[model samples]
Target: MIKFFKKRPPANLPDFWKTYENCFLEKQPEEVNSVRFVVLDTETTGFDYIHDRILSIGALNLINKHIAINQSLELYLIQDHYNAETAKIHGILKNGRGTECITEIEALKQFLAFVGNAVIIAHHTIFDINMINQALERHQLPKLLNKTLDTSTLYKKTLLTSNVFKKKDHYSLDDLAEKFDISMKDRHTAIGDAYITAIAFLKIWTRLKSKGPLKLKDLLKLGS
Candidate 1:
């Protein structure tokens, strides 16, 4: 049944995407400060484009520099395809740990409900976002409409582009986590990692803002 839907396109795409996209069409505040941002991640079976499947999704919402524990998206999916090779990095064993699994469609529905109208923030935004989009496509749903901000890009903004050191061409979750002293307690879990990313982003924003006024558009800066 799942295979029939894979990569084809989503059916009965929830109305949420339309509404979320509409938020963008409206006039955005000139000050880039008052926006809601969602940071998220996907645990996949493997790195293979064709073989890998999303095993889980973890995310947290950031509004006005606050992160509330009750408001997070942690979804475990039922995936027959599990990769032992990536287990060490993400730690989701086949039928071993983590919460009970939900179907891919169920997870997407819940994810949409949680993420509605908020700008998405993620580390390596494309992969995670695309993973979700592929799932949506399979369900016949359209792509996500929310604006996206990548922390890797935001982290780069903290660096000085003095034409020396090249300002670290790339930034990884591990790098930002270490720099900010954030514990990897919920390391392999989606929500735990999302929390880590959220905190790291805050620290980066603080440092950048100290230099001058900050705005939502400014934080959306993926590059220097």
Candidate 2:
């Protein structure tokens, strides 16, 4: 099932995106450290957009630079199409094979409830977002209402200004984990990578807002 946003923009989305821009109306805090962010990911069967199936969604909530392991969401989904090759990458088994599993609808409902108007952050956000949107489309739920940030973008801001320390075209979770010295014990799980991105997002927030006002507008602008 694939869900598309209603043809008209939701009140929260600007006239630009047309799925409800109003959701963004809530005033963001004046400081960078005071925001609530949802860091998340999906474990899928493979790379083919049409052939793949999302096996899981793992997410954690961060508030004011703090992460509470207890305040996280981990949902395993039932898969109709399972790929054996990628199992080594994500480790999710098909056919009710996981420790705990839920249907796509169940996972979507839980994710919506957990996110509830918070901004979402992820590394290489487009892939995860596309996977989620596909799932949402399949479920016929309204499209996501929250704003999004990508750690791949945030991490770049932390580099030095000199041309000597030139930044790369793209940054990976492994690169940041190595650079920041964050633990990699949980490497590929949705929840684990989310934790890494959350920390990286926090670090970037600290570096960028260290000498600035750090308004909500500032964060939305980070995408540009």
Candidate 3:
């Protein structure tokens, strides 16, 4: 006789989380131009995912090649862990930055609502996505279900094979800014960097489309 282990029941999630999850029930758009994309950046205390915490999150909505300035989101979290060294980099003080800081849970709620089921875009997406997921885990919440695109990865595909030797293994946001001629005015700030990444993504997307037709699946494949 074989004995099987019982599956664990789903954890009771809050209404906001439930609402966020519900958005995924609708089918995702197949056309690249039709899909809503959320370009985001997160400033953290340090590199250690488990040990460090997110100091702030900045994101904006992009659809049909247009950046929705009014839909942009910027949230600062009240941190229990702060690194002075990193603070010098991001400039988010423990006390506050004249802007009101919300609790991590509150930030998560707002972030989820703002994000919905939109595809996430970031410079180095894994780090930012992991940071957000870790925060969600800490609150007994599940990780984000949205698809993601990394500008660094997507930008790499825009390069020509003739100049293969000139390609670097990794491309930094600063490199994209200089190559695309975007301003570096908000270099270290989360929202500023996100805006820069959004611009870089648009430029990269346009270049990719110049070669051939680019559907959402095709772009996601290239990004992956």
User: TM-scores, in order shown?
Assistant: 0.84, 0.84, 0.95
The C-alpha local distance difference test score for the whole of candidate 2 amounts to 0.77
Worst 10 residues of 2 by lDDT: 10-19
**Mind giving the per-residue lDDT tens digits that candidate 2 earns over 98-200?**
3677788778777877876778898988888878877766655456767788888877766777767878889999998987889998878989888888887
Candidate structures ordered by lDDT, highest first = 3, 1, 2
The C-alpha stretches of model 3 lying farther than 4 A from their native spots are 1-10, 162-164
Candidate 3 residue lDDT tens string, 1-224: 99999754348989999999999999778899999999999999998889999999999999999999898999999989989999998989889688999999999999999999999999989999999999998998888999999999999998876654677889999999999999999888999999999999999999999998789998988895
> Could you report the Cα RMSD, in angstroms, for every candidate shown?
5.9, 6.0, 2.0
Error of 3 at 217 (Å): 0.5
| Model 3 local distance difference test score | 0.93
Scanning candidate 3 in windows of ten residues, the lowest lDDT window is 159-168
**What is the C-alpha local distance difference test score of each model?**
0.78, 0.77, 0.93
